[model samples]
Target: MSTHRIRFLAALAGLLLLGAGGNAAAQSTITCESRNGQYQSCSANTSGGVTLSRQLSSQGCWQGDTWGYDRNRVWVTRGCRAEFRVGGASSSNNTGAKVAGALVLGAIVAAAVANNKHNDHDDRYDNDYDNGYGGGYGNGREIRCESTSGRYTTCGYVDRHQHVEIRRQLSNQQCVYGRNWGVDGRQLWVDDGCRAVFVVY
Candidate 1:
C-alpha cells in the first residue's frame, strides 16, 4: 500500500526478468545420465551420440567417479552407489533417499526443457531460411534475376511456392540447418529447400 513498498516490488520484478533473460541467452546445455546395473565398461556419450572416455570429476559435496565401457554395456566403475540394507527402511525414515530422488527428477526436467527449446530454435531458423527464398514473385512466373557487379542475384516474383536463384557469386562457405542446406558457392545463393543439405566436414 505504501509507495516505498511498491518501488521494492517493481525492483524485484525487474530482477526476476533479468535472471530469466540471462538464462534464456545461454546457448549451452547440460546433459547427465546415470545407470547402475551389470556393466562391463563406462563412458560419457554426448547428446549427439559421440562418446568421451575421460572421467568427469564431481564437484561440490558430491562424490567423484570413473567409468568404463564394454561391447554391450557401459559401466560406472568407481562412484557412489546407494544401496538399502534389508530392514533398514523400517528402522529409518529414509530422508536422504527422498531428497536425492527429488534432485534427480529436477535435473531430468531441466535437461528436457533445455533440449526442447534448442531444437525449436533450430527448426525456426530453418523455416525462416526456407520462406525467404522458396518461391518466385513479381510479374513473371519465374524468379527475377539480375547481375550485380560480376555476380548475379535472383528475387522471387510472387508469394508462396516461388523460388529464387543467384549465379556467379562466390560462396566460400555453406550453411546447414536442420534438413535444409544453403550453398554459398562461388556462384550465387542457391536455396535447395531441405534437399542437398550440407554436412559439417
Candidate 2:
C-alpha cells in the first residue's frame, strides 16, 4: 500500500481506540422502570449528571417529571421505562446523598398521609357536631344583595328569625330597607338597583 494510505489508516485506528476508551471509561448503562405506575429507584453511579440515553417503553420518558437522578441512584415514575447512560459520579465526589434523599422522600410521603388522615378526622368531627346541633342559631353572617340592571337580585341564605341590615353599599343607588331591599324567607332580595353588602344576624 502507499505510505500516505498507511499513515491515514494508523491515525484512523488511533481515533477509534480513543473513542472506545472514552465510552468504556465514563459511559455505562442502567435501566430504571416504573412498575404498575409507581415510582421505582434503581442503583446507579449518578454524580456528573444523567441523561436518558434511550427510552424502552411506550410511556414518555421526561426528565424532572418521569425520570431523575440525585446522587447515587436513578429514579423513575409514572410508568416511564428507559435505559440511561450513567456518566457515573462526577470527578468531584459522591456525598452519600442518595440515602438521605430517599429518607427525606419517605418522610414527606408519610407526612402527607398523616395530614390527610387528620383532615378526614376533622371533617367527620365537624359533621357530627353539625348533626348534634340541629336548628341552632349560628353566628351573624354577611349577605350581599346586588341589583343588576335595575332588577331584583337575591344574595345568600337568611334565617327567618334573624335580623339583616345593610352593612356596606357598593353602588350609587340608595338601598332603602323595607322598600327596595328586604328578606324573603331564606333569601335576601333587592330591587331597583345597585349592589350592597348586608349583615344577616
Candidate 3:
C-alpha cells in the first residue's frame, strides 16, 4: 500500500474508535427509587451523543396530612438530574371525605325510606280522599278554570261593562241561564287586569 494511503487509513481507524467511545459514554444509565411501589424505567438515544437509561424503584410508605413529599425516584441526564417526591396529600384527604360523604348519603336515603314507610302506614287509617286535585282561589274580578278532564265545562258570570269568562265542555253541550245576560260588544283592550286563557281547541 502507498505510505499516504496507509497513514490516512490509520487516522480513519483512530477517528472511528474515538466516535465509538464517545457514543458509549453518551449512553449513560441511572437508577432511582420510584416511591410508588412500582418501577419506572426510561431510555434515550441521541445522534452522535450518549443515550441514557434510567430506572426508579420505591417502597411506598409515606404519609402527609395536607401535603408532603416522600422519597420516590431520582433521574439524571447528561446535564440535569431531578428528584421526584410526592408532595400532595390532598388525594388522601379527598378519599376520606368521599367516604364520609357516601356514608351521609346512605343515611339520608335510609331516613327518606323510613319516613315514606311511616307515612304509608299512618295514612292507611286516614279517611281523607286523595282526588289528586290541586286547587287555588283568586280574589280578582276575573276567574279562570282548567281541567284535565275533557268532559267537564267551567263558567263564570259578569255584569255589564265588566268582563266575564266562560269555558265550554266537550261532547253534547247545553247551556242554562237564570238571569239576564248583559255584555257590550267585544273590542280589543289591553290593561294590567287582562286575563290569560289557554285552550286545547
* Candidate 3 CA-lDDT value: 0.30
Clashing pairs in 3: 26-50, 26-51, 27-50, 27-51, 34-57, 34-58, 35-58, 68-87, 69-86
Which numbered prediction scores highest in lDDT against the true structure? 2
- Backbone clashes (count) for model 1: 24
Give each model's whole-structure lDDT.
0.31, 0.66, 0.30
TM-score, cand. 3:
0.15
**Better by TM-score, candidate 2 or 1:** 2
Ranking by lDDT: 2, 1, 3
In angstroms, give how far residue 66 of model 3 lies from its true place: 40
Per-residue lDDT for 79-192 in model 3, tens only?
222232222122232444445545544555555566564554544212221221111222223334322333233333322222233344221322211011111122211122
**C-alpha RMSD (angstroms) for model 1:** 19.7
- Clash counts per candidate, in order, are 24, 1, 9
**lDDT of residue 131 for candidate 2:** 48
